[model samples]
Target: MRKSDEAGTRPDVVRIWIALGLVIILIIAAAMMLVEADTQRDQQEQVASVISKLSTVRARLEGAINGNLLAITGLIVEISMNPEITQEEFSRYASVILAQKTEIRHVSAARNLVISHIYPLAGNKKALGLDYRQVKKQADAALRARDIGGIFVAGPINLGQGGRGFVARTPIYEFSESGVANQGRFWGLLSVVIDVDKLYGVAGLTSSNQTIEIAIRGQDSSGSDGAVFFGRPALFDSDRALLDVSLPHGSWQLAAA
Candidate 1:
């Protein structure tokens, strides 16, 4: 009878051990699911933060560009009214504008497709007498600005003066003797060189950002159809936040991850 009881107790103990093993397995699976859920939540929050930063940068960049462009309008008006503006007069006026807006590298005027007047001619003397028709890269945009009778931005391209910058070009039509702008008489092109690094720094897009990686494409404001001008090209292919930078003639695509 005692031997029979021991056999029965052995089976009961085996059953209890099996049940404990199953419970342990379930607990581990649940813990893993919770960890995965937490990880996903964290990733979503991180992505949200990056997107917010990108939006803020976009606004700042646009504001900086538009502000400087608005300032250029006054100079354009002056040039339109006086198509015979001399280098000395142009330099003096440009000096005042530059003094107010430090981000502007230089201001130039092209009369009959020939670059004639450039302000702060110290470093930019090389660009003087540059013929827009001769330069293939810039010729198209310059012509487009004239034909469209509006402002067209080009580059982040290699400049004759040195370095790379965005050139905002607007067709300057001469004012009639009656003090009215005559679209029929296209006097020249007015261009302003924006310091790329300074502009980016003002927009908080310099290399100082450790958490977010940013890339800008759409050279010449061609939007996604254009090449990458800032940051890595691969960034656009990745799962990144994208925004369109509204420019004068076209748009730039901004990506952040």
Candidate 2:
């Protein structure tokens, strides 16, 4: 009788140990699963925050570009309407634009395809005997488009004589009895060359540690692949610096990290 009782007690003890071991394994697996879930959630939140900040930056940039274009167009129209604009008058107007170092980098006027431009750093020069239409295919196309009231951003063109820059063209127009006529009968194009660095600086993003990049791709040049205008070291090294935004008309993407 005593031996039977002892054997039964031993079997019970072994069963209890087996149950305890199974419970311990289950607890460890559950803990690991919870830790992984938390990590994944944190990563997702970080990505969402990044995307939100980038969108805000994009909106601000677009607004700034539009505002700048509008102001420039207004100035061109004012100049074109003045029948007696002397060199002094022209210089005064150019000075006003030049003063806006953050927005207007250069100002130019073209009459009968003759180009005259002024830069803040280098002062002013007339591209005498040179026809702007002869230089750029897009310029020719824009002239033909007959949308004189419209504004165009053009070029990574070589501004010969130690000059290399981009151009913005705003057509001048006047209303007539016959029809809506281009300012100067489409004889002239008001052109402005913007300093890319100054334009980017207006975003007030210089102090930011976050990655930022701006690209202007025209019908002319495609942007660089891996160049990050502003970014952290990790993003700068990554090939994914460029954003997936669609290029604007006559303009390219401006991205920030």
Candidate 3:
């Protein structure tokens, strides 16, 4: 009851204060842990959402790329039937199909590795005479495309037509005049240039409300491996959602955060 006793450091009194302080500290710690648990849960949920979004975008974008591949298939077939496929005919077929695929900037055909026909050449005359094999940057890709004997893709390179994009190339093997089924020889290539920014925009990474960042790294269209054709390469190494894009002729790694 005395002031001295009230202020005294009695063993029991010290024990009482220590117990009370311990209770308060425990309560604060539990509350903080609960808040942290909620925060971690929310963060995990956001990650799940982003992963789901990435799956949807991957499917959609792959479909677009496949559609481009198919469009060129028709041209490839026609050219196979007649390696001398007319410029007028090629332009007609390509203009219509390329018009349907907004991601594709241009469609072209080459004979013996020479640019023989190109659709929408109005803005691409510079490409008409440009030989892929003649250029250092394009030669390896061109040769690889020819030897790989499949649909190849190259670039994230600047176009002679005046833009940055990717080119998808497929070797065209045509039958000889002898009309032998097995005697078909490698004729040339069918190339399509895809607008990178526009393609990613379609992939939903460029939307005004887009939040998830994405990147890709894989074999380029020219049969070169371990190249980051889209987005940042480091993102592939970072913690992100990874999806595999199965192309008609190849595969690529897709990463999203």
Q: Is candidate 1 or candidate 2 better by TM-score?
A: 1
From the highest TM-score down, the ranking of the candidates is 1, 3, 2
lDDT: which candidate is best?
1
Which lDDT tens digits does candidate 1 get at residues 1-257? 69999999999999999999999999999999999999999988987898898999899989999998998888888888788999999998999889988889999999998999998899888888999999899899999988877888888877666677888999888876676655448888999999998899899898566468899999887999999999989889965589999998899988998
Task: Compose the digit string of candidate 3's lDDT tens values, residues 156-248.
Answer: 788766768877888888966787543588888888899888887887767877677777776563222568776777776756467777765
- Cα RMSD (Å) per model? 3.5, 5.4, 4.4
Using Cα atoms with residue i matched to residue i, what is each candidate's TM-score against the true structure? Answer: 0.83, 0.63, 0.78
In terms of lDDT, the poorest run of 10 residues in model 1 is 175-184
In candidate 3, which residue ranges exceed 4 Å CA deviation?
A: 1-11, 176-183, 213-237, 241-257
Predicted structure with the largest TM-score when compared to the true one: 1
For 11-91, candidate 2 gives per-residue lDDT tens digits of 899999999999999999999999999998986675556556656555655666665665565566565576345556666
- CA shift of 14, model 3, Å: 4.0
Segments in model 1 whose C-alpha atoms lie over 4 Å from true places = 1-36, 176-184, 207-210
CA lDDT scores, all candidates in order: 0.88, 0.55, 0.79
